[model samples]
Target: MTDVFFYHLQSRPLEAALPQLLEKCLERGWRCAVQSGAPERIEALDQLLWTYDEAAFLPHGTDRQPDPARQPILLTTAESNQNGAAVRFLIDGAAIPDPSAYTRVIHLFDGNDSEALERAREAWRAARAGGHEVAYWQQGADGRWVRR
Candidate 1:
């Protein structure tokens, strides 16, 4: 069973939190696929990952690239895991119809959005019942992530 992580964002927005997680994924030599509920959010996330930091960089792209497998981070609105990513991030209420293909699934939901929070709750229950290892992470007062 795939390891499922639920990140409850209490302070920073997804824009500020995701890159940090992606950076950690890179450090662990794991490729990542970030999925959004809409194509517009995927496109926006693509640009944000590129320019979020002036000095740092996260090499990533969508299917529009020449080679998807070469991307350390792949962003998309679809549920396909074509990039061979070891980690899959479901952002902005995105859901994976088939998650067995992934080693891990990260669910990052906005705490302010009641619908998103509810969706996350349902997902956690379903995944846990499916015998997957589940964990919940929340941003601490110092803006650091503490798995709760």
Candidate 2:
């Protein structure tokens, strides 16, 4: 069963939080695919991953790039797992793909946006209905994830 994680972004924006999570994924030797609802968001993420930290480099490429399957992290707007990623991150209200396609599926949403919140809820229900193991994490006062 796929482990589905719902991250409620309240204390910080996705830009601040995503790199850290992706870093953890890399540390675990997992390849990742980050899917966004908009192509513009994917473009933004492509830049963000490259320069999020001056000392750290998260090797990634977008679907538009050549040899997307060779990328450690592929940023895309499509639902297909082009990189053969073990983990898939759905951000910016991206539609959830089949849970079984990856080992883990992460859904991150803006807590401040009502529409985003509703979408997250729907995704949560869908994940549960699909019999995937679901977990919810919300940022605590210190900007740390506390599974809820």
Candidate 3:
């Protein structure tokens, strides 16, 4: 069963939260693929992962890489998991068609956006109905993820 996670972003933007989550996945020795609904979002995400921090370096690539398997992290608008990622992240209101294919699937949404919040709820219900373990996390006052 795929462990489904919903991250409600309130205190910080995607740029602040995404890297932290990706870092944790990397520490767990898991390859991750971040999928966005729009191509521009994918392109923006690729740049964010690289320049988000000065000291930190997240080795990632989009379709420009000669080999997808070699990338530790991948940012793409495609639904296909070309990197064989252990974890899949759906960002910017993106939805995964088949969640069970990955070890974990994360649905991240901006809490401030009503549409995003609605999408997260729908995703949670769908995953639960599918018999997958679901977890909900929201940002605390200090911008840390607190399970709710």
Candidate 4:
């Protein structure tokens, strides 16, 4: 069974936590499949993948190598109606189809953006309905995201 780890937060990019998460997965001999199509997410992951590729941190096996064409961050959307994956990190109204396919879901929300807030709520509802483990992270006024 695939295990899902979610990092939901307010106002902070999920990419900030990705390096640490990927490192942890590598430590455990697990390769994570990031599912996102956001340009920012892709760009960040690309750097990490390169770091791993160049042996800056550690040697990366095929499992750790991110697919360039089909970035692990964004899965194929041919099967869904949503233009992008269902993620509410920086936007609103993104839907994740077949939540069961994901072992975990991370919901990040910023109290500042109404769209983000709506996406967060929707993600919570969808995750609950799909019986998936979802994590929430919210940004505090001090400018840090704490798991809520």
CA lDDT of each prediction against the hidden true structure = 0.90, 0.93, 0.91, 0.45
Candidate number of the best lDDT = 2
Clash pairs, candidate 3, are none
Clashes in predicted model 1: 0
Task: Name the Cα RMSD for model 3.
Answer: 1.0
On residues 93-147, what C-alpha lDDT tens digit does candidate 4 reach at each position? 3345565543444443445667766766766666666666655655566656577
Give the 10-residue window scoring lowest on summed lDDT in candidate 4: 81-90
After superposition, candidate 3 runs with Cα above 4 Å error:
none
Which portions of model 4 miss their true places by more than 4 Å? Answer: 1-6, 10-12, 39-41, 48-95, 108-111, 139-147
Error of 1 at 92 (Å): 1.2
Per-prediction CA RMSD (Å): 1.1, 0.8, 1.0, 6.7
Global lDDT of model 2: 0.93
Q: Model 2, 52-143: lDDT tens per residue?
A: 89999999999999899999999998889899999999998888557798999999999999999999999999999999999999998788
TM-score for every candidate vs. truth? Answer: 0.95, 0.97, 0.96, 0.54
Local accuracy of candidate 1 as per-residue lDDT tens digits, 1-148: 8999999998899999999999999989999999887888888888898899998889999866688778889998778887899999999888998677788899999988999999999999989888898999999878899988
Q: Which of the two, 1 or 3, has more TM-score?
A: 3
Q: What lDDT is obtained when candidate 3 is compared to the true structure?
A: 0.91
Number of colliding residue pairs in each model: 0, 0, 0, 17
Off by over 4 Å in 1: none
- lDDT-best of 1 and 3: 3
Model 2 TM-score, 2 decimals: 0.97
User: Candidate 1: how large is its RMSD?
Assistant: 1.1
